[model samples]
Target chain A: MSDLPKILHVEDDPDIREIALMALEVVGGLDVVQCASGAEALERAPGIAPDLLLLDVMMPGMSGDETLTALRKVPQFSETPAIFMTAKAQHSEVDRLKELGALDVITKPFDPMTLADQIISIWQER
Target chain B: MSQGSESYLVSLLGPATAGAVVSLAILLMIGLLARSALGHRRQLRKIREQEDDLALQRKAVDMHAMVKITGVDGRILYANDNLIQTIGYSVEELRGRYASDVFLDEDPRIAAEMWETLRRGDAWTGDNKLRRRHGTAIWVKTTAIPKMGRNGTLDKVITVYTDITDAKLRQQEGPLRAMFDRLQDEVYIFSVDDLRLHYLNKRARASLGWERLNYRSHFLSETTSTFDEARFRERVAPLLAGEVEAVIYESSLSGRPVEINLQLDESVVGEPRFVAVVRDISQRKQVEQARAAFVATVTHELRAPMTSIKGAMKLVASGATGPIPDKPAQMIDLALRNVDRLLLLINDLLDLEKLDNAQTEIRRDPVNLAELIDDAIAHNMGYAQEYGVTFTALPAMPSTLQIVGDRDRLMQVLTNLMSNAAKFSEVGGVVEVGLEDRGDEARITVTDHGIGIPEEAQSRLFERFVQAETAEHKKRKGTGLGLSIVKSIVERHGGRVDFFSIPGEGTTFVIDLPKASDEMSRAA
Candidate 1:
């Protein structure tokens, strides 16, 4: 909410998580705190206050929307903006995630180099 | 009474015998008068008894239910008291009003057909829907008898009706049970209180092995091969509680797959029942599971790996890993392009599968065809430019064309057609998308001045997995499912698609759709 610094990211798959970290940290040089599941995200939310929330939808236990819902209950992250990364690539799915109040939806198999620019562009447009 | 005739008779007769002859004549006249009086009395008595008999018959008929007399023209001439009380109309209000207008439906054909039967000297008996005072419709069992006049012409028709609305609402009755017994699918009638079987159709009897078991004593929980009493009760609890009319589920019966629909027969009082209809669904389940598995594999299994593979390939191809040699880089480009093609194939498979099994609902919203055509041409212009072809939308159509269809699906249809045309068109040639205002139907045309379809393959072009064997076969890239998807979407909208082609000359693909207003009118 304040600046383009810290991001709280949650995804179930380790490979996608590694790629996302490479895309965001190594390439874009943005600070981020990552978690494996929604429960872990909840556990880390009170300690690390991130500017934005990046999440992967269609997880095993809780979906990205549910993670956002759980995090919004925290006082520090109540109004934090969220973006979702999804492998189920359908335009309707994007619309649905947007309806759940995501700032933007990035479809799967995305180009890693431009992933940072897409998020930054979205932030600027908003 | 003639005086002259009497005097002539007296003169003719001898004066001495005149007194005796006159006395005999007076006695004969008195006897004739008494006999005439007796005859009159007997005839009057007979007439009075016949009138009494008719009055009794009329009273008995009136007490039965509503009764009305109509003229040959079907105008109410008289109505009984029961009729007046039941339909909320007085004798004066009903008299001379066409029976069709007062009691029958608004359709004149029903009245005409009923009268046609009556005039042919046959009684009309059927269930009739009668409108009450506040426009509520009630069902009635009606019997109309035709009365004839002395001149042998149809004089009037007397109709008798009894209220059958309650019975009609309780649709499960003796007559319907008889029909249920003859059904091809298995049927079971069971008591709701005890869950004991009451009746079973022949199919149910044959398949249930009725050699030694007493069907009447059998319980639902004990009948099916994989009977789960707790699960079945949980499923049917809503119906028993009146929350729903029926509950349906698929389970194995006699170790075979079946779909059972159970409905509570609460309409009958004192003895509540359940009607369960079972259908064998082994074949359907097989087909459904196969389709579902394929889609699941494509979406869940292949998609995750494809994401990693394609992304890694793209990062490598773009030299994000490091600066690679020219030869290997070109091959990486080829691999990336083919990966993209595989992704496209996955998407096409998804779309076609959804359309095939009716996973997507084709909406009937009114859409402007002309605007959609223009949008499709604009959207595909970049793709067309890749083929050295220019996509063009014709000038304003003569009239605005509107149709009932799913706008996105229709766009998919139009875009597919335009791209197909653009792909095969000659280099630097123009491909046009146009709309035509057919009166009852809206027409969309996609025309290309490229190598047209061959006469032989043209007939099967729209079939799935079928493609034209063009000279540049390797050049045209597709999943061979685009035209079939187009056909599927168009058909779902109650429309048709066809093409006119001359090989090496040109091809024009046309899609005809029912206009929105026309579809609405047809539904009405």
Candidate 2:
């Protein structure tokens, strides 16, 4: 991990993306790149060479799970740690997300002040 | 032909011969009259023998048949020995009695209508219940024929009663009882006075684990633990008093859920009784629970947008983007608070779904009660401040009240209790949390000095979406799922939750969790 970890954040909801951008870039002073959808993230992720992938589980063209599988096919991104953000926070769902190569599953409507710190913690642990 | 010449010759010849001829004529007439008299005597003897034979035939019919003759005015004119014996009455006792008085019907107008029909010179035949001397009713088929007099006026009504009680009962019981026994639902009949089990269909006997000989005299309570004497009386009071036609309730029998439908059967021959039909409803309940979970899942999914909206507002309100004006900041704050309320509703709905579906995972770990309470208080500090209340953990709290349970779920329970305590407390009121170490369990009590729950609402406080309609609660927004969730979580950890509340003084909620054994702690 670098002093300022480069992160790729993929979300379908523009408002949630804006909030996460502010929380990571403005509030927590981390280098963050935002994509409107998983397809856009797949196009930009490898070139950006981000240290972490923050993906929304529900999407329009490519779901977070599909995007993760696609990113794993890329040689450089095969072992990159990915975290899932989902509205469903059931214990079983979280465990399932972890089994799908996600380092952790963060429930939505996350506290804005703690969101960046939570991501950093995950990154540092990874 | 020789009358004139012969007469002249005879007149000269013999006076003695003429006298002899007159005597012969007289003797021949006497012989003819004697033969006619003997023939009349023989015909008279034959007529007398025919009259004796007709009387004997009538006597044989009267002996076998239950014959009664009533006059034109409906008064009994004659009653035969068969009728008197079958009616358990003497002929003298029934002779002067009105025919209607002996034959009774559930409907009095039936007898009246029959008599009217007979008066119209028509025969009446139908089944009737005839009362005996002992006041018991015997069913009979009756035929009454009106006998017209020689002057062509209504004369007498001759009625014959045939015993049909046994046959009638068989006709009623054969197909009817068979149909009742073939039903999938369990059927029961309980005596009205003692509430003793009078009859149970085959399904009822098998479902209730009863045998014919052993359950004959058993009371209803013996078969079901759900209905003791008092509860049975309470539930059946309306049915017995005829206040309601039927009553329905749900109860568990042998740990299986059943719906019981009880109806008053006052039309039974003797005493009024209760007829209950019980059907197992466990599958129905499971389906209902599943549907509720589905609705909750959809609702939770719907909250995703609200979550994003609240998150955006929160970020903007924190001055992360830029400094905001005071009015917009206040607006954002208000929106944020409402968002929190919506989130609470969504969370409560999800928790209920999880609880009902048994999808909540319990990962047992050693949890310390005192530390959990302290963390809960700290977590709810902001809420306490908003409610203008303070939370205090008693200094005498046990240091190590350990239990085996999921820490996060237990923390959720404690947080709910503290949040409720803060919400219900008066301004500047102090909420106290205390712990007691019993031998086998640890008890935690949360006491709040505030307007307590109303007496009427206390019983249903833990039911889903049931909020007390008090003035204090009216101003506060609650999903009413906090306490129910607390109860579910505590119970899943092998604990019990209860509360004591005074209407105007204060309330105390107690939760008891079983202590973890050394071996269990080591195993965990």
Candidate 3:
């Protein structure tokens, strides 16, 4: 893995995905590969060899947890750090996502400028 | 002249012939007298025997039944022993009293009807509630027949009463019948053995469109359209077998949603019976659907735009694109602040909705109160700084106080109180958070040195969307649901939340939570 983190962002909403990409790439100066759905992320994840996974909890097909489970099956991505992005900010939901192997859970409508910092903190912790 | 001539001839013929004629005449007279006396004696004996038979029949009726004889004007001429004993009255007390005043209902119409039937010489057979001497009433099944005089006018009424008080009382006292009759929900009772309907309240009859005359004869299967035979049997089998206390299911009856609660009444007299209460829930269901749809639309349509606006504002405020001028920067700052307020309002609205609907489930776990307070202070430190207020953790707080509750919800309560304190505080005011150990409970108090709640608004402080109408509150925009949400969350965790305040001085909020035991901590 390179010094600069390579993140794979999977979100169903095009607007959120585009803004997040700009935040991670332009504002934070990091490499990001964005996918519209979990299925798309799974297909491109092996080729991208991203250092981390940023998955949305509520998605059309293959939820964040389901995608994480599928990715963990692959030997190369077994121990990759993953974080969940969701609108469900309840403490119970956050704890449940953590139990499912997410490094952290970030709530929606997050500060765009600070989003990259939040992700970087999680990456560094990993 | 012929007799004189016959006497002269007889004297001439012989004295013996005259003596024989006299003897024959006397013998004939004695035989006739004897026959008349024998006939008169036989007639007297027959009359006495008939009177004895009538007396015996009257004695038998008086002994076995409650008999009473009333005159034409309803005067109680006589009352049998059974009648006097059952009514708890002496014969002297009942005699000569008007039967209507003694035994009939207090209603004038019923007494009038009884008299009319008797005057018409027709028998009156019905149930009557008669008041006793001691003021208690007894029900009797009565039959009164009018006796006609020689002139064919009604002379007297002979009434026979059989006590039916026990059956009447049982019917009244069984399973709260009076209360069931007054209920709005339809109630029905069915025999467990045959699944036949045994009783239905007035509401049930009216709701099911049943006629009073035929309702009692109808079976449960014919009355309710919601449950077929197989489904009803399946649902009722558990109750009949004492496997479950009650069976509740939602189904439609008469094209409307209804909730049916059925339970077995094993305490009923002969056999176990099933009692079911059916409530129409269409209106409640409609309201729930409308609320759910509104929440979904608000979450989706509103949050999507909010996400974009907040994101764009954050980028502008961060100076990511380019450096902003002074005036523009100030406007951006103000706009961002309002945006944050709007976000808080949205979050508070959702939380209040969830709490009101009881959809928010409290997850109880062992939580360290001291750590939770520290985290709350850290999280709200920015707001305190913005408002030029300081938060001080009083030394009274215990080092390792623990309780069983949902940590997130408790933290939310602390955060709400802290934020409110910061908003209302003077520039140099201090907000203090303290904890006290009280044996089995942990008391958390938040004290803020700021303008306190007005006395008039204090009572309604925890009501949704109610804010004290004051200048400071007007300037500070809020959803007015924070306190209500805090109260709900605290109460759901089996805790109490209360506050004390003095106008223009300060306010202090206290929350008491049960302390966690070692077993509870381990289980959590």
Tell me the TM-score of each prediction against the true structure: 0.61, 0.53, 0.58
Local accuracy of candidate 1 as per-residue lDDT tens digits, B1-524: 36776677779986657667777888999999999999999999999999999999889878877899899887899999988877788888899998777766535676677778887878888878776665456678899999988877788999999888657754746677678777889998887667888777778888878746678778877676667767877888889788778898777887888888999875543246789999998888788778856774567566667777776766677666778899998998898888888887787778788677643557667787778877787788788878899888888774457887788899899878888888888889999888888787888889999888888888889887788776574479688889988998899887899999999898999999877785463443
> Candidate 1's residue-wise lDDT over A1-126, tens digit each?
446757888988777777777778767778878999999999988898887899888788988899998888888888888999886655567778898788899877677788888888776676
In order, how many clashes per candidate?
0, 0, 0
Error at B328, model 1, angstroms: 1.7
Which is the winner by DockQ between candidate 1 and candidate 2? Answer: 1
Q: Could you say which candidate leads in TM-score? A: 1
Writing each residue's lDDT as its tens digit, candidate 3 over B365-442 gives 889999999899999999889999998889867888899888888889999999998888899899999999999899
Sequence-dependent TM-score of model 1: 0.61
Enumerate the candidates' DockQ scores in order.
Answer: 0.35, 0.33, 0.42
Which stretches in model 1 have alpha-carbon errors above 4 Å? A1-6, A25-32, A89-92, B1-43, B54-181, B184-297, B363-366, B398-400, B517-524
Tell me the lDDT of model 2 at B71.
Answer: 87
The CAPRI class of candidate 3 is acceptable
- Model 3 DockQ reads 0.42
Candidate 2: C-alpha lDDT: 0.83
